[model samples]
Target: MVKHIWDSDRAAKLPKGVEELVYRSNLIGSDRTVCNWGGGNTSMKTTEKDFRGREIEVMWVKGSGSDLATMKTHNFTGLKLDDIRPLIKRDQMPDEEMVDYLSHCMIDSKHPRPSIETLLHAFLPYKHVDHTHPDAIISICCADNGKQIAEDIYGNRFVWVPYVRPGFTLSKMIAEGVANNPHAELVLMEKHGLVTWGETSETCYQKTISIIQEAEQYVNDRINQHEVFGGKRYQPLPEDKRKQILAGIMPVIRGAVSEEKKMILSYDDHDDVLEFVNSVQAPALSQIGAACPDHLVHTKRVPLYIDWNPETQDVHKLADLIKSGVETFTSEYQAYFTRNQQDGDQIFESAPRVILIPGIGMVNTGKSYAMSKVSGALYRRAIAVMKGATALGQFVSLHENESYHVEYWPLELYKLTLAPPEAEFSRKVALITGGAGGIG
Candidate 1:
């Protein structure tokens, strides 16, 4: 996490509300680049008093689709400050309507709708707000020991809240939590991510960076330095065996790819491909999950670990592992869900999308090769971050029940829901699997 500040060229000419826009947008966009895809938000509040002589009557906030890493002033949609203040004080509101109401309060008349979490940003009693699905922070939260670790690392400086749907209900939960822990400088939402704020844009941005850096450093110190496990050192295979191995993998993956994504199948797998595959951490890399709530649908709670069997040159054996991995995972997931579930909640799938085989490295087996591949890549980054988070102290994340609530929440269900009527068949497509080099 970098404590972002306005560049000298821009800060030198701070244009009132523009300063908040520049700093807050950059702060959020930067974090979004590393971990989230359509998942995070940020904001800044300006009271009517702050603009004493000016006609500007609203607070600026991040807009939907704006990447914090490269957000410009136009990326911020402004909202009436007075309108937001009163809503946060209210007891309830529908989630979807909240965005519409917030939109009506936009500070900039021509800008697109602001981020859906705008109200949640408003609920925070600070001038600047920052949130992200940081890979390192989230990896720790997904682990079995997440809660204890978080308590050990953050201590009193942070307030930890259970995972909630990211809208009115979530905002209400946070507002109440903040009221209870008024002194807390930071808030950590379990199975989600971190939130930090301050009196100024710089203060809020710097605080967020500093806190994340602290967690990163803490994790780094505890990383296992040795490359070899027990007496084994990972080594590459002979060129022919490698080619043969690739050949087998290519066919299965090609068989699973859709026509629109067929171009991806033609990509060649060579030593460079092998090298990339080999670089993935296998045995100890099983800890990564979604950096926040949204990522869970893609990566799941844990990755499957498989080791090479010398007697098994058969690809069917490998396929069996993939199938069995899903069964085993589903069983374990159900067990975890059943043990932690609240009233009326149902358990989800036991299938595994990403698998890590010791010597063979990582294999993605999702609905398509690309989707599965992305999941694998995500896990690698997450694991690296978790290793770093450990040095900060023990990692803490959402309790099991909290994770269940978010995973099964109606909002999340909307995403998991299938296409309606005949659209379901259209949503499905052909699957191609294999490399141009005659291996998959």
Candidate 2:
């Protein structure tokens, strides 16, 4: 279960409002169990002076593409609440128009872009609001019987919202749900995450933690009763053997997947990774789709799983198998893109960001070390979500069409443009022999 780390003494040191909101966001985001990196957002509404020196209500929200764990005051965008709240009455707002309208509401043009869910935070009548994609909450949200499970767990304290892509419509639906159920304390967006609010930042943060704890306890109680991944079908090889095998086959796998662009590879053989990859269910589970929509941007819609018998197959045979797997994955990915392509959509590389190898572990591919490491970490979280959901009931992943839309969403892709252009050595590895002398 996620720990309750809120410190009253420490919180007392910070001034209330956005300062308190940042403290709460950092506390929740520090725990990966509470939310994936860059996957959740927090906000607070406060009265602040405008350019005209008049006090005006403003909503300070986490900036787009910012990680909650490391954000500061400057990382949040403050928008005039009066300008934003009126939009709740609109029957519908196109995502593009909504984004444009939001820009117009910013208190300062220099603040970063407001999060995609800024409207949700503004529409809800609360001083403090938090929306997080906790693993435990998502496990219940991603199960086939998720709605029923939610009803059993929280009764009427939380409102269940059917799956809706994040934007104006979802924000409206959630507002209406809460308006109808005035006493609801939390909002659960199906196949999405949790939203909690309170009159104070501390109240909102504690409520978020308490709700996730309940969900975690519920999953933990039932997980052991069910066979894990239908009982692991294979055991990991010895550490020395696993590393030797990877050393020989890593280059081969890398070469095959880097046809479009060079990629750095990150390998993980953690116990949990081995447990999943060696299971009878890994291939099928990995192919279904991402457990959460947030994972699609980093890990892709699905990973490429290489079926290899570690005990019976040598490194050469494993290399051959990776080659075949890459060929098949590339073709299937291309087909997925062809089927889902829209007028303005540009196809991403057909290669998979993640690859699963039985008796070995998982390998993530990216343009840099940090990127590859993040992919591996997020995929590990997906593994955890899969385990918990399957234990509770049938695990339900995002549909292929929905997955494609998120993976190629224009707004999401825009985040990449914010980074500086790559340098000459952006993806190259260099060994500097004089590093100790500072010259390197």
Candidate 3:
């Protein structure tokens, strides 16, 4: 369980502690086990002076793709609450148009757009609000008996919310849930995560910590009682040890997973990565949708898992097996897109971003090294929650259609088109003599 790191002595000197909120946001967002990179959002409701020196209500929400660990006040956009509040009553809006409207609501259009969850934070009647996708909360939220489990642990303190598609739909559901139980301490979104609020930043942050601690303990107790043999953290092989596993096998898998662009591989064998690769259910659970809806944009709906054990598998024949596996994964992904894609859905690259090896651990691939790392990190985060959820009950991930919708979300898909193309290096050569012959 993670503890709240707040310093009152220092907070007294800062202006409104917006800086303190930024500090807390980084603490929560940076913890991979708590919330993967950019997987969650946080906000604070406060008064700010506009250009005319007029006092105006403003809510600052984390910007898209901003890593909370390093986020500054500039990374959060302050939207005029007066403009945002009106959105609560507007019955329906397209996701893309809604994002446009949110951008328009910004007090400073120059600032990055506020999160889609901006409205959810604005709807709540609190001074400080923090939202996260902690694995401990996930264990309870995604359990087979999620509601009852939450009620058993939280009683009347939390209001259990059923899963609804995120964005305005979720914001609306939250609005209703809040109105129904004004005194509720927390809100548990089934198949999602937890939400908590308070008058002060410390209260809200501490409450979040306490909730997760209880849930973590609950899962651990259940595992011990049933003798379920909770998962272990696998030791990563050293660089020398990894040479045989990845050296000769990478080109084969990378080349096979391509059409026009070659794939770059990111390898890891950390505890989280190993937990998934070594799990009894890696093949079954890794194929289920993303850990959270927010992860779809980064990790895709599923990771491609290949069954190769470096310790005993035949090294010479590894290339053949990998080629077949990549082909199978590609065909299956294309079929998934064809069957599930809507009329206006744009086609995406069919290659897998993440891959799992039996003894070698996991490898995530991308067009670039950084993207491959992000892909691997997210899948590893997803698997952590799945492992924790198993201890409580049968782990449940998002449904197939739900996963498809999020991965192809119109507003989200539009953002993909906006990314700058990767920089290219052109060929330039100079004739040079061998070391023995070259002279100035």
Best by lDDT: 2
Q: Model 3: which residue pairs collide?
A: none
Q: Could you give candidate 2's per-residue lDDT for residues 1-440 as a string of tens digits?
A: 79888999999999876788889999989998888978899999999999989999999999998888988888999999999988988999998999999999999999999998999999999999999999889999989998888888999888889998899999999999999996699999998899999888889988999999999989988887888888887889999998998889888988998888888889999998999999989989888889888889889889999889887888898999999998899999899999999998887777889999999999999889888998998998899888899988889988999998888988788767766787898767688688788576
Residue 288, model 1: lDDT of 36
Whole-model lDDT per candidate: 0.60, 0.90, 0.75
RMSD of each: 7.0, 1.6, 3.7
Q: Candidate 1 on 196-310: residue-level lDDT in tens? A: 8888777776787777777665554555453311224345566566566657764654343222233122222333233333443434434434345565656666666655552
Error of 1 at 87 (Å): 2.3
Off by over 4 Å in 1: 1-6, 13-24, 31-35, 47-57, 107-110, 143-155, 224-244, 257-291, 300-316, 319-355, 364-377, 385-440
List the candidate numbers ranked by lDDT, top first: 2, 3, 1
Q: What is the TM-score of each candidate against the true structure?
A: 0.67, 0.97, 0.89
Question: Taking the tens digit of each residue's C-alpha lDDT, what string does model 3 give over 1-440?
Answer: 56666677766676774686787787777677677676677888889899999999988888775767788988888888898788778888777777888887798987876776777798887888877888878877777877778777878778777887768878878877877985688888887787888788778778878888888887767756652324432333555767775888886777886664676777887865765676566777777667677688777788777766555657666677778887887888789888899998866778888877766777787777777898888877677677667777777778888888878877556545545766673111235567576462
